[model samples]
Target chain A: MNEKLHPFHIMILIYMNQTGVVIMSLPHLLAENFGYNGWLGVILISLVVNLNIFIISIVYRLGKGKSIFQIMESSLPRVITFPIYMILIGVWSMTGCMVIKNYVYIYQIMSYNTTHAMLLKLLIDIIAYLLIIKGIYTISKAATSFFWITSWMLLLQLFFIKDFEWARLTPFLFKGDTHFLTGGFIVFTAFLGYELCFMLFPYADNPKKFIKSVYKGNLITTLTYLIFCLICFGFYSFEQIRNMMYPLLDLLSYIRLPFIERIENLLFGFFLFTTIVSVVLYSWSAQETFARIVPKANKKVLAFIILTFGYIVAWFPDTLSEVGQWLQYLGYAELGVAFGLPLLLILILVIHKGAKPS
Target chain B: MRTMPKAAALLLVIVIIAGCGDQRILEKQGFIQSTGYDLNGTKNDEKDNRLMITVDIPKSDPEQRMQRETLTAIAHSSKEAKILFAGQTELSLVSGQLRSTLFGVSLAKTGIWKHIDTLVRDPSISQRVKIVVVNGRAHDLLVRDYPQHPRAGQYIDRMLEKESALMSFPLVTIYDFSRDYFDDGIEPIAPIIRENKKNISFDGIALFKKDRYITKIESKQSLIFSMMKQNFKKGEISMKLGDGSKKQEYLLFSSVISNRNVKVKRSTKGNFNIQINIVVKGSVLEYSGSHELSKDYDRKKIEKRMAEYIENEAAALMATMQKHNVDSLGIGRNVRNSLSYEEWNKLDWNKEYPDADIRISARIVIKDFGKFK
Candidate 1:
């Protein structure tokens, strides 16, 4: 593989994964746990995750230019390495499918009455197939273009400032310590994408710049999610947000554009594109992880097969509420794979030194 | 080179597929301007909880010039009724355009959290929708013909906005209602809309203990309640001063603005004392007196009168709300946030709130009068 793609490309991929699905869903999940202080939890989680990313990047740089997979393979047996790689790939693919499914559910609820569940699954599979066929660099390029375009929509939230109630965020600290831990865990899930750095570590043209790119990407996503959470908390009270199935969509509905009556429709349209980019990048990364493990397998064909399987998994969730609950469980499992495994691998690598590649 | 045609063909297919999923214009589907929930007396027995929902659909044709056409359906649940109503209507019943929701006296008294939960859960309905308590039946409020506004929903929405601005009622949106419904301490209140001749006026605000409208605060007192609780940019306060001839004058003042600061302090004895500071600015729009007052009136006398009037109004509003056991002012919320839930529970707010020492201090500064001499 040619080391032509910069660490900036890795940053774009991570940014796409974090922003698209998490921003839309985090407020509701946080509200369920922390009530009104959900936005505060988002801020806390972002700060914590960025610190984790910084620490992880330092650890990666310490390992010279070798990827986490290489470090893990050298540190552990091939049996453990193969299973860990497969599990990591599975987590990414599941998360990708969940993101696509969530966007489709939002679209069906907001825009069209007759939007078939199968349509979104098919769309995800098609995009994944095309991106995989073109190779990982093409997918990274598409993500980079999307990152630039969607950065503007972050500004559109300013229009809703008038409706924000600062009083809703009152009594900042919880009455009890229990709420903080529960809320912290939920918000931590929103920052799960930063761990993508582990997989994309080898693709960075400049491995030394990996820390810089990861910090920049994580910072952007953190700030964006914080703003989104604040806007949601400001608009809907703690209880209203908890009751709402799709709190972000509800928040957008309150925003009446000067000319356009429904702002959620426009948001839903833009979100569809971002959601596609998010799922495609995740699926492509998952396919790449699989390709690395089995050198004999064709990457494109494997990508298609995995994406089709993901579509089936996504389609199986019966209702919108069920899909959301399933995603929470998936998020917990992905969090373990994304952060837990890497931390463990980094710890093991520190204990045992790796031999130089011939 | 061989894959170029296949890529082009694939791009063409993507474009075609994308074109198939374009957005649906909301106006094309019949938009529901407002929804009214009422108890269906005819449908079920006392044990059965049946609700009839009246949806106001705007007539599309300008020439038709109809105020509004309503479709009513009774079902076991709101979602069921909405679905049933959709089947009855000619156009798709779009809930996004919904501006207000009215609950009938009976329906409101029965509690509306179940109905509100349905409204909030539905993705189509917006959180900003104004929720109000109708004086009479919700169906009558929706179905009755009005001369002023073309649509009943528009009429009710405009009336609520006007009253809320005038400091007659605290602005109660669907979001606010839902917040109060779930909060342990704070109770919610919705403006009560009633018909007078051909037009509608906000006569009072319906106070909700949870989702039920437990009590009502009439027009003048509702103003005082609003002023004490909410920030107002514009309003009017008229005072009848003195007796005939010696009656110096009755002042009709407009352009009234007020900012109230409420502080809750726990006394050394463990009881709470509330201190209210009302900073007011207004113009004497009309003064029927012998003295030809300039742009600036006797500052001392105006200030004294303003303080007296505000104090009297505030006291009366508080007394009225207490008499009815309606804590719509969120005194309970202040207490809960100030103290623990266990502590708040031990001291019955309904009993203690009225007895709590409420000291009000008013500061008035006259900004302007419309070119008066």
Candidate 2:
């Protein structure tokens, strides 16, 4: 079943998950830290992130057909694998919830002024459940289709080129090196979902092609993110972009289409599509992690259980601002799971001289 | 077979939901085409900072004319003033189609930045809306109707676009005003509108020293001021030139394209000197005499003559602006952006701006003319 997904499909899935919420919020976050040169910080972060992908690909290749979870399970004790998997599942589910909540909040802000919040939550929950039921291959196909949709939507951003002011990107390197370094770290956290590929290594039809997929995915995601950052920088001044909460949405709101009075609504739907794909991919990873931990557990049942739990977790945050605060904390925690866990797992695999190639 | 029914139901439901979102809310919501704010002074034995707000909404007519209505609300805050207008007008003031926000001279003098902030922060209000200051009362600009246009909002909007396009005034949007208001080095300039004989036109540009309207630059000077700051698609300059025999010739040259480059350098006297280089690509439309030599005239001679004329005009304009303490040319911004903080503080930009040696140079390359040379 996993063999059906082409390397391109996997690349689209990974790119969508990494680029969605991160691109929408990173400009505002980096601007708050670095002020005028926040965009420069984003460029530096993209470079570092691409380098990090190279390192991760090296680590994944060193594992030799063993997925990160499998390597962790074999290299470490059963006691450690179960607990670590549980923690990983919890973090993934929380990340999924945050993405859904953020996307829903944006939808509500742009579209339904009078619609009940519960109805929107219910709609998102039902959609997530249906996608989860359809399984990983179907989700990958959906993500592949969405890749084109996102590209076309991105092309519409050219209308705002007339308003682009190069002066807004000026006072280059103004906030100094320390601010840039710190902002880069914050931006690095935004690209956290790249490690999802490490978990899906065993499922890949041609595991040899995993490195190529990861590099292509990272390149596409980085380029897309840079385009968004450039648009935000172009549409608004440095101070205005810095002050904005969701610079992407704010930038979209400024775009006026002839037939579509509010382009933000259409943009909101496109972003929501990406967000849903991201959540589904992460949730599937979490569910599979749980299934691997419990040998007797049914994978389908576990998927359903995890999807329901994710819905409950998403409901915990009553308001958008609270969800944002939770996501910030979750982002910090993801640093450990996304970066530290892989490094540790890779280190242990090397120490034990884990499984050679078939 | 059972799943077939379920899938069909789902598809039907999706189609129905998609069809339900077809309401033209903006049209029904009575779009506030333009808004005006005025200081109504204290009223009724209360120290109420009264505000008069005018909302222009599309009139319910076959002709699609706009109905202009004014609501007087006594409130200490602009937000309250807006809410009061909502109560009086009985229509939710939708700002999505808002063309411009006019501020009366009195209100502008009292510092209307806080009021403007309320409009800027509202997500519903558009940032592209033009912001202007009225020379007389804001109500006059909003209330007066043109026989041709009918709607005051549409009239003011077209007038602003025409004047800005003609290179007579700077196009100042709400976003531009807000950005300049926040930025320290740059000052905001908005078109000032006035009503005379039931017709409206751009009176001048109200120059703001931060939030306060400090001075006004009337028509032709506004053009010269904008020329220094912005690139124009088309501009015309009529110059009076003398022949070798002292016979004067009037040359009408229309610029097809123009670019201005401003550079600020710290002088040895611890002050700043600005150098302006203007490159123009234009065609000679008309000349006083039959001095047609050829299509390819002396490019160097034309450049020199045009350069001298532009330099004198630019220097005079800069001197006049310096006298009025208007830094609309963004000299301070250039200094702050290009220099370090310590170096910027050492030079008093406001004091040195007027007396600073403004050297101007123009390079006019004639592109083409009509049928005549």
Every model: Cα RMSD to truth = 3.6, 3.6
lDDT of 2 by residue, A98-136 (tens): 777777676666556556555565566567767776778
Could you give candidate 2's per-residue lDDT for residues B258-334 as a string of tens digits? Answer: 88887878767766777888888888777664455253455456556666766677778777667878787776677
The candidate that wins on DockQ is 1
CAPRI docking class of candidate 2: acceptable
DockQ of 1: 0.40
Note the chain A TM-score of all models in turn: 0.90, 0.91
- Candidate 1 has which clashing residue pairs, if any? none
**Candidate lDDT values, in order:** 0.74, 0.72
For candidate 2, list the clashing residue pairs, or say none.
Answer: none
Error of 1 at B118 (Å): 1.7
DockQ of each: 0.40, 0.37
